[model samples]
Target chain A: MIVRPRLEDHLVIGKYTGKVIVGVGLLMVIPLLVSLGFGEWDTAVDFVISISACLIFGFGTQLFCRTEKDMNWSHGLVVASGAWVWATALGALPHYLSGHASSYLDTLFDVMSGYTTTGLYLLQDIDHIANGLNMWRHLLTYAGGQGIVVIALTFLFKGTSGAYKVYVGEGKDEKLLPNVVHTARAIWLVSLTWLVVGTAALTATGIWLGQMPIRAFFHAMWVFMGAWSTGGFAPQSYNTFWFHSLTYETICIVIMIAGSFNFALHWAMWTGNLKEIRRNVETISMFVTLSVTTLAATFWLAKANVYPDAMSLLRKVFYQIVSGHTTTGFSTVYAKAFVTQWGPIGLVVTTIAMAIGASACSTGGGIKGIRMGIMSKAFLQDIRRMVSPESALVSQKYHHIRDVWLDDGLVRGAMTITVAYVTIYAVATIVGVLYGFPLDQAAFEAVSAASNTGLSCGVTAPTIPALMKVTYIASMWLGRLEFMSVFALGGYLWSVVRGR
Target chain B: MMTRTRTLTVLVVSGAMLAALAAPAFALATYPPNKPDSTELINHQNVLGDVTKGLFWNGKAITFHGEAIGEVMVRGDYAWIHLNDDAYMVENIEEGAKLGGYNSGMAVWVPSALTKQIDTYGDYQHEGSIVSIAGVFNGACKQHGGDMDIHATSLRVLAAGHVVVDPVRPWKVVLAVVLASIAGLLFWFERKYRYLLRQSGRVGT
Candidate 1:
C-alpha cells in the first residue's frame, strides 16, 4: 500500500520542533546563571545575549507555526538539523566571552565539539576558567549525549506521534521498553544513577591521589558525566592526564564501558531480567573488540618501549583502547607523546577503534557497533555461499536472539553506506594532508574528528590551517548526525530553494 | 682488541649524544622563556625588582637601577612607564634599550600613588600619561586569568617607537579557505543523494 505524505504531519512535527528549540533556549539560561554566579561578567553578558537570541528565534518559530498535527520524516529531519545548528550557534557565546578562544569561528568549533561530545577544544587554558562556566561546558556534553530532543520529548511531550518522530529523529532506532517515553526516562534514570555513583567513586580517588578537595570534586563530577556519557570534556587543562593514577584510569574505563552499553540492555537489567546482558549483540561485539584491541595495543606499546613494564603497559593500552572504542576521547597518555613514539601502526589501530565507535542506542558517537555486527554477519554468509558446491542450494540464516535470513539487498545496502562513510572519511584526511599535515597525523586527526572521538595527535590547534579546521567541523557535524540526517536536511533545503 | 673496545665506547657515546639532541625536538615545544604559559600566567601588582624575570608590561621593560615607588601602567605597545613621587599622572622618561618581561600584549591598570617617587625624580607629564603600578610576575594576562600589573614608585620609559601589531598570518587564512571549500563540497554531496542515503536503511528489508 502506498502511504501518501501529508502536510498535517509536517506541521505537527514543526510545532514540537519549535518547542524543542525553545526548551534548549530555556536550558541555556542555566549556564547563563552559572556564568554570572562565577563573576565572569563577559561570559555572563554573552550568554544573556545568546539566550535572548535563542528565545526570540525558538519561541517565534513556535508562535508562528502553531498546529495540531503530527511529524513526518521530512519534518523530523528539519527539526533535528535545525536544532543542532541553533545549539551550536548559541553555545559558542560562553566560549567567545570567556576570552580563551581567539575568534568566533574557533569558539564555534569548540562549542560544536562539546555539544557533539567530540571533546576537541580550541580553548588554550581551561584551568583558569571559572568553576561555574567549566561545569556548563561538561553539562553541554551530558545533555547533548542523551540528546536535548530526547530529554524534551520524555519530559514535556505526551503525544505518541510526536514522541516517536522525535525519538527516531534523534537517532534512537530501538525502543527498550514498550512506551517510547518510558524507554527515554529509563535510559536517563540509569545514566543519571551511574553518573552519581561514578562521580562519587572518582572524587574519592582524586582526593586520595592528593588533588585539592574542591577541584577534585568538580573534576570528578565533570569527568564522570563526560565519560559515562562518552562525552569526553575533562575539567582540567591537562584533560585526563591530570589524574595520573592507575585507579583514576580504571574508574574511567568502567565509566566509558557503561556509557557505551546499549540503553535497552540497561532497561532490561532494570526490570530484573539479567539474561538480557548475555543476549545483547552490540555489547558482546563491543567486549570482544575492546579485549582484542587493548591486548594488541599493549603488546605494541611494550615492543616500542613506550611503556616500561607490564603494569604500565596495560594501563596505557587499556585506557587508550577503551577511550577510542567507546569514542570517549579521554587520554591518560598525551597523544603528542604517543604519536612520536609508537609510529604508524599505533595510530591506525586507534583510528579503526574510533571509526567502529560504540554500541548503538548509547551516548557514544560514530557508525556504531550494531551496524558493524550486521555488516560482519552478512560478510560471513557471503563467504559461506562461495565455499558451497555449485549445484547445491543454500539458504543462510544468522542467529542473534532469533534466526534471521541474510539477503543480498541487505548486504549491498550496508556495504554501500559503509563505503560512503569511508569516502567522506578519506576526503577529510586528504584535506588535512593538503594543508601540510603529515600523512599519519592527518589520517589520525581526520578519523578522530569524523568519528566525533576528539582523540588528537597534537595536530588540532587554533593555528591549524582554516581549511583543516572547517574539514574537522564538517566531520564532527556529519559524525554526530550519523551522516544521514545531515543529507536529508541538505535535500530539504535544496528542494525548498531550488524547486528540485 | 683494545682499539675495538675504544671504538665501541666512542660509538656508544655518540649514539647517546644523538639521542639526547633529538629528544627535545621530539617533545612538545614549550614557549620560550619570555612567552607566556597560558594556564599559570596572570597579570598582578608587583615591585620593579620582582618584575625583572616575568612578563613586561606594554612597552615598558623595567630594570632596578635603584628602589623606586610609583603606580605602573601598560600602554598600547610593549612600553611600560612608572610615575615617581606624587600620587598623580605624569609624562614618563624614556629609559634604555631592551623591553624586559613577557610580551603577551595585555594592559594592566594600577594606582598612580605607586609611581609617586618616580614622578618627583624624573620627567613627569600630568596628562594622565604615567601611573604607578605594582604586581607579581604573572606570565600573561588572559581574559580567564586575572590581570597582571606590577606596582612601582618611580616613573621611567626605556624608549618608544611604533609598536608593530601582528596580523593574522596568511597561512591561517589559506588553511581556513581550504577547510571551508571542503565543507562546501560535503554540503553539495549531502544535498545530491539525500533520498538514496535516507532510504538505504529500509531498502535492505
Candidate 2:
C-alpha cells in the first residue's frame, strides 16, 4: 500500500549527478581564465560566482546523499536527463551575470540552446558581450556537440558499470573502445584533434583574409567550434556573412560535412579501413536525403530566378541546403530571404533537410540519418515482401558497424523516435503559429528549434512571445535528448510525486 | 493712420519670423547635397525593405546615420562597413541609455580612404562612431553576389564613440565570495564523506 525509493536510487543518482555538476563547474574555469586574461573584471567575477555555485550545489548533493550502488539503466537515464537541466541552470549563470540576457529565462534559453547545439540565441547584444562570455557560449556548444556527459565520464566517472549507462543516456550508443573510459577518451581524442586541425585551418584563412593575428586565432577557434559541432553561432550577428569571403565559406562547408560524419566512420577511415566510408548506412542515407532535398530546393530557386549565375547559385543556394541538411544553421543568405526570395517550395525543402538532420554518433542533431535510413530500408523491405511470393524468405540488411539486420524491434524503435521528433516539431510549430507568426515561418523556426537546426525566418527574437520562447527551450531540450530519456525523466518525476 | 501703422508692424514681425525659419533651412542646404529627392534619412531595414513594385526603396543618394559596428573590412581599394541601427541607438536617441539586442545593420561599401577616418567601432568595451553616409541603396547588389548593400559616395562622422568602463560590482564580488565559502564548506563535508567511505572501503558509482 506504499511506494518507496530505494536508498541506492538516491545515492547513485546523487553520486554521478555530483560528478557531472563538478564537470559543469570545470567548464566555467576556461571562461574565468579567459576573462582574467582579457582583464574583463566584471565577466571574471561572473565566472567566479558561477563556478562557486556549481561546485557547492554539486558537492552538496554528494554530501547529503552517499551510496555504494552502481548505476542501473534507470539511474543512468535519470542522471543524464536531470543533469542537463541542472547544468543548463548553472550554465546560465555567467550569461545572466554578464547583463546580456534580459531575464533569467532568456539566459537559460541560451544555455539550453548552446548545450543542445540548437543555435537559437536569446542573449541580447551578442556583438557587445565580453570575450569570456562569448567563449563560454561557443565552448558549451563545442562540449555539447561531443556530449557533456562524455566529459564527466572521461574525467570523473570512475566506475565502469555506471559510467557506461550514463554515456548511453547522453545519446551516444557506440562503444568505441572495449572500456567505457577508453571510449570516452577516444571521443575526446577525435574532438580535440578536429579542434586543432580545424582551428588552424580557419585561423590561417582568417589571417590571410586580413584580420589581426589574435582576433584571427580566436575567431578561427570559435567558428571552427561552431562548424565542427554543427553549431550555428558566430562572433557577430551577421554570422558567416560577416566575413563575406568565398574562401572562408568553402572551408566552413568542408568542416560541416566532415563534422556530420559518423565518429566510427572517422575512426575506421583514420585507421585505414577506408572501405567503411562506402559501407556506413548513415552515410548512404545522408547522401540520398541530402541529394534529393538539395536538388529540389536548387531547382525551385533557379526557376524563381533567385540567383543569376551557377556560381552564385551554388554559393548561396547550395550553402543553405548543406547547412540545413547538416543542421549546422550557417546561412549565406538573409533569414527573411527564405520566405521572400526562396518562396514556399524552398522553405519546404529546407524544413525537410532540417528535420532529417545529420548522421548519428556525430556532432549534429535531429531525426538522425540512422533512423531515416532504417525507416527507408524498412519501407523498401515491406514493399518487396508485398510484391514477392509469400513463401519466399525475405530479410533486409544494412551495414552500420557491420551487417545489421532489419529486425521488427529495430524498425519499430527507429520509427517511434522519428515519429516523436516529427510530432514535437509540429507542436512547436503550432505554438509559433498561435503566437501570431505565419504558418510557414512558424514551421521553419519550429523545425529549426526541435531539430537543433538554427535557421530562422524571423520568429526567433527578443520580441517573440514568452510562451513561444518557453516552447522553443523545451523543443531544443527534448530534441537533444531525443525524447525517450526525457519521457523517462517525466515518468520518474511522476512516480516520485504521485506514487505514494 | 494708427490702424495702418499697426498693420505694417504686424507684417514686419511676420516677415522677420519667416526669415528666421528660412535661415536654418539655408544653413541645412549649405551642407553637401546627397538625397536625390527629399532631405529624409532611412534606416537599414527601410532601405533593404519598404518594397514598392519589387523595388525596396524608390530613391538614390540617400542620407543615413547609424552606429559603425565591428571593424571596417578592407579589401583592395574598397572597404565593407556595417552600420548598426539597433534598439540601443534608437533608445539612446529616443528612450534608454543602454543599448541591447543584436542590432539591425546593413553592409556598406566605401572607399578605403573613408574607413580610415573612423576612430571607434561598436564592441564590448567601446561604443562605435555615429556616422552619416551618403549612398545609393541596392536591395540585391550584383557586384557582391546579390547582397543588400549601400555603395557610399561619402561619409561624415556625426559623433565620436568612447570606451565603456565595466568594473566588477562590490556586491557581485561579495556574492561570489559567499558562494565560494559555501563551496569550501561543501568541500569539507565531501572530504569527510570520502574518508567515511574509505574507512568503510566502499567504492560508489
Best by TM-score: 2
Worst 10 contiguous positions by lDDT, candidate 1 chain B: B88-97
Per-candidate TM-score against the hidden true structure: 0.69, 0.90
Query: What residue runs in model 2 are displaced by over 4 Å at the alpha carbon?
Result: A1-3, B1-53, B58-61, B90-100, B199-205
Report fnat, model 2.
Answer: 0.46
* A1-500: candidate 2 lDDT, tens digit per residue: 33545677877788788889999999899989988888889899999999999999889988877776678887888899899999999999998888777788988889998998878887777767788988999999999988999999888876567788888888788887779888888888988998999999888888777676887888899998888888888888778887778889999999998888878878778678889888889999999988998789878777766554667766787788889989888877667667766777888899999999998888888999999989999999999999999998789999987899999999999988899999999999999888888888899999999989888876798778888889999999898888767777787777777766
- Lowest lDDT sum, 10 consecutive residues, model 2 chain B, at B39-48
**What global local distance difference test value does model 1 have?**
0.62
- List residue ranges in candidate 1 displaced over 4 A: A1-14, A36-42, A389-405, A408-410, B1-205
Error of 2 at A351 (Å): 0.6
Count backbone overlaps in model 1: 72
Give the whole-model CA lDDT for all candidates, comma-separated.
Answer: 0.62, 0.81
- Highest DockQ: which candidate? 2
